[model samples]
Target: MSLRGRVLGITLLLLVAALLSSNGLVIGQLRHDLVGQVDERIRGLATVAARLPSLPEVAVEDVPQVRATVEQQLIRDVHLAYLGPDGGVDRVVRAAAGRPPELPRLDAAAVAGRGGRPFRVPATGGGDGWRVVAVPRAGGDGSLVVAGSLGVVNRTVRQLTGRVLLIDSAVLALLGIAGWFAVRGGLRPLRRIEATAAAIAAGELSSRVPELAAPRTELGRLSAALNGMLDRIEAGDAARAASEERMRRFIADASHELRTPLFGIKGFTELYRMGGMPERADVDASMSRIEREAARLVELVEELLLLARLDEEGTAVPLHLTPMDLRTLAADALHDLRALDPQRPVTLTGPGGGPPGGAPVLGDEARLRQVTSNLVGNTVAHTPPGTRVRIGVGTEDGVAVLEVHDEGPGMT
Candidate 1:
């Protein structure tokens, strides 16, 4: 079943159980109280009958006087019986017209042994049966038996049961209606979350569940959690898109760089084949140009491969880390720069005049050397030939700092 149905079903089930329990208790109590009232009335009537001042003192043979005395003293629906000292039934009287089903007879021993406490006996009178109490006469030797019918008590309990069932039906109907609405309202937030998810699946990643009015409720917590997940997913998607764009740009740049050398080599080979280089010296110069372009292409390819490996796994580029002086690496880089272009004035300044054991750092020596060369090469490639370059190396704040400064027209 749906959540709303399940919730309503369970709620009604519990309500029904409670109503049934209450009805049972009500019916049981009604029966008990009514029966007790009947018993009390019977005992009171028996007390009055026994204490009658006009009752005749009669022998066992005087049945008419005994019957007359019982009829005069007893009320309707109350039957009276007298027992002798030996527990034999001496006379019986009915307050009403009919014989009233035979009242219980007491044995001789019981009549003689009767006490002030009243006792119950089953009645043979048919309709709803009867409850009889026998009380001993206060000033006499025999016992006075009084009996009342259970019909009134049974009828009252039955009527009460009917009314309880009716009330329960109405209560259950009202509760079922109210419970359905309550459950629907409770699950509305989940429906909103589902709609938001569907919108996101349809490419609206910005869609989000609306904030709940009550943040401390269970549904509110679920909404918050779902929104958090969507936020993360949207952020990840944006990052992935940016990474893909960067990859596209990197590929385009690499392709352009590769094309330059390839075009040079192809042009040189075509000229050689076309017999444009007639002399041996011209052919040798063209071959030398081809070799130079080929070496540049190979270096570019190696750099691209290294970058790819690094992208795949950061640790793919192995490094042997050891203590090395940044000053020495800087001085070597300056030497190489001057060899490539002697007129470019470059200076190195730091601790110990930028010599060995100046400004030590933990790094791979070869990688540090490559880094210095790349920085100096970038300066030479981008700046004018006469640019004054300063390569500085020092330790500050417990860190080695290498800086390359140039006096050429600086980049915008």
Candidate 2:
């Protein structure tokens, strides 16, 4: 069952138990008092009959005198009867207003044995029950059994029980309804938080629990803590994405730069094999170019390992920053390109596109060299071999600019 249902059910159960127990006790006490009043009246009538002026003052001497005294004193509705010592019964009179149930016939000897105490007599003729008391006649050996009706007590208790049942049922229903709404309102915030969690699971990591009123309240504090945690989670996710992007770019640049030196070495070897380096001067020049490309390749490989370690350990190392000319980097690319493909015409120029000029910048020399190498390598990889190339270096808008242009089929 739902919590609301259970709470209301338990409350109603306790209420019903309390009502039943309390009402039962009250009804029982009322019945006892009413019955006591009946017994008192019976005893008083017996006492008056025993001390009657017409009878012997020592003990009841005649049954007729005892019966007359009982009838006279029992002013209201009551049962008056005489029981003889020999088990003979003599019903003298009954209540005039109603047909009261008859009193049981017991041995007069037994009535005298009980010392005239009152007792209950269950109904035998199916009318109302009776509270009875038997007293011995002072004038004769008989019992004066007086009985009073229990109809009033039964009727009052039944009426009260019926009313209590109706009132308790209505109260239970009203409380159930009110409690349902209260519990639903209390759980509304948790439902919203559940929705936010589902949204995040569906890939909306930016989703957050809605804030509530009163930061000091439990629900409100929970929302604040959840939102704070989500913020950190989102930031960490974004940082991871950016890191992946940087790693991709670094791998691509390293691959291209590595190709630049390898392509130069391949060109030198192929030229010597095809007899293009016929003279010793030509072979010596080709070997020198091969050695320089091999050195640049080694530097690029070591830099790749260093960057990989830095990414893993989250540390930094100082760079070899120096005042270097962009022209020097561009001229070096032009040299390697010419060595790779001698037939291709490669030109070096300044900002005005006239001739090579100085473009000074304070930066790491190895990083700047790799940047120029990647530009030249991309040009060779995409465009056809022996394509015309232009390498430039100059300052534009107070910013150093290096441009590598090729005259071949443009990139598709």
Candidate 3:
């Protein structure tokens, strides 16, 4: 089952258990109260009837008054009996023709004395189950007794119990429904988390749980944690792509730079081997070309080593980072660039803006020189003949800016 359904089901089960227990108590109390009321009323009516004159000795016309009083104050058709010394109903109110033999008999000795006495007996002249009470006359020796049939009281009790059970069941059903909705509402966040996780598993790296502001619940914390993890994963992936791109560019540039030098070396080595270098002049020319190619190859290897060092240690390496004169640096770089390609027109512009003489910037002198050399070498190798290259230094904001602008086909 879903978490919501399980939570709701467990809640409803507890509610039902509580409802049943409470209703059980109520039913017990109700039955006790009803039976008490019935017994109390029976006792009171028996006391009143026992005060009447002895039966058969009292006028028959006066019996209707006793019957009327009983029917008015208590239940109808209550059996009235006068028990003799033999303990049976000596003169029952009706003396019916077909009274059940198993019906209770009043004890004569218990009700005979001057003061009234009451006893409970089974039904007499009965159509249903019954209880009877006998009491003695207040001023005479003989007594009067009252009996009751319990059928109506029993029927009412049964109906009341049935109604209570029905109400309890109805309440439990309603509780179950309410619990289900409540659980669903509470677990909504978890469902969203589940979906987010599924999307991530499907390779949607950008997917994340929506951010929660100062979340207060466990599920909310879980969402925040998952989102944090996703952010780290995305960053790692982007870094991986960038590193791969740099590696590919490095390999391509290295191959291109080495190709010309390698071809020259091969041509010269083959010419020297084929006996074409038998003459001193041809031999000298071929060896010189071969030596130049070897030097170019060595230069390429050194550049590759410098690049690898930068990649490994970054610019954070401990190096001399003193303030340097920008004009001096630019002039020196320009002289080196012109010497390498004297035919190419190269110019060095003076410091644009500085406190005095030139802008002094903090950086490693050796590394900065390497940077200038790389730019000059790149321009010399790629730019057409007679292209103008301008190297300049200036202060932009608080930082020194170095510009190496060239006229021949600016970078691809």
Candidate 4:
């Protein structure tokens, strides 16, 4: 079975079991009560007849009235008789009967002094039985006996038992249907999540379940987390692709740069080895070109080293974080730039709040200064002779902010 059906089936089975158990108990008690009521009433009528004063003979005229009373009370197959002092029937008042089925043994010997008796007997024209009660009637010489049938009570119990079984079956079926729908409703969110994941695995990165109607449950939380994870994955994948592309371009450029210098050095070295320093001018020019290439190689290697150091020690460098004077640093850098250019001027500006105290940011001051130096050197290398540059520093909302604004092209 599907999950819905399985859950419904299990629930219905348990419910039906409980209902059967309860109904069994109820029907059992009800059957007992019905029989008890019938038997008690029969005993009561028997007692009344027994208490009537009996003469040496019971008149047939009085017998009709007694029979009418028993019939009106719906006691089936009632019979009245007086027993002689010797325990034999002396007179009988019975209506419309061949002979009633022999009653189960009454054990009258046990209750003879109590003036009553009761027992169950096999009944004719009915399924599975009857209840009988016998009472003793007093006479001039001995006592009389009265007996009646309890087939109606037995029949009523059978019908009630049938009806209860039918009701239990109907209730069980209805509950089974209800449970199936309930389980389906509960698992709807899980099914949607499953579909979303499948679509994503099939290369549909945009696939996502709508969260608006999702159940506020553990599964709903799980779906939300999955969506968040997918977002991160997509972002990381895009970054990785871009990084790969940049690395490819950098490798190509670096190879071209290195090869051009090496080729020149190799050609010049071959020329100098073949010809002894024929002319001073020729030797000097060749040496100068080689020296320039060597310097370029050295600069490339130094840049590479700086890049490596930044990667390995990016956020792990040891440094004491304290309030620093950004204005002083900017002023010193501007003075140095002016000494170098003698024309371009550098200036510093910001709100005068001595830099706000952020959660202490840690870094090596020497490395930070190197980074600032590199920025200034790059600006000087590219900008016009008289281009003006400015540095700024401030603090806002517990964060230190710095900006280097130069009147030069920012980037290509």
Query: Would you list the C-alpha lDDT of every candidate in the order shown?
Result: 0.69, 0.76, 0.65, 0.62
Task: Order the candidates by lDDT, highest first.
Answer: 2, 1, 3, 4
After the best TM-score superposition of candidate 2, give how far the Cα of residue 154 lies from its true spot, in angstroms: 1.2
lDDT of 2 by residue, 313-377 (tens): 77884499888888778877887787677788888877658866678899998988888888877
- Tell me how candidate 1 scores on lDDT: 0.69
lDDT of 4 by residue, 31-118 (tens): 7887777677667766666766663345434555565557656766565666555556567655324345454333345336444546
Per-residue lDDT of candidate 1, residues 172-267 (tens digit) = 999888888998998787788888889999999999989965679887787788889999999999989977875786696567556645655665
User: Which residues of candidate 3, in runs, are more than 4 Å off?
Assistant: 51-53, 56-69, 77-149, 164-188, 198-204, 211-214, 253-268, 275-412
lDDT of 3 at 172: 75
Write one digit per residue (lDDT tens) for candidate 3, span 1-412.
8677777778878877887788778777876665565566656777766665554644333577665665665565455666655566566653322343244444556554423333334444545555555566566555566555566666777787789788878887887778777777777777777898899899898999975445777766877889999999999998899788778877876775665456556656665676757899977866775675577578677776666567645553346788886666676556545545556787666344232235688787755755665666677678898898878786667667676778887766
For model 4, the local distance difference test gives 0.62
> What TM-score quantifies how close candidate 1 is to the native fold?
0.65
Candidate 3 global TM-score: 0.57
Q: Quote each prediction's TM-score.
A: 0.65, 0.70, 0.57, 0.58
True-vs-predicted CA distance for residue 169, candidate 3, Å: 5.4
List candidate 4 stretches off by more than 4 Å: 54-62, 77-108, 112-127, 134-136, 139-150, 164-186, 212-216, 235-246, 249-253, 270-299, 308-412
- The 10 consecutive residues of candidate 2 with the worst lDDT sum are 53-62
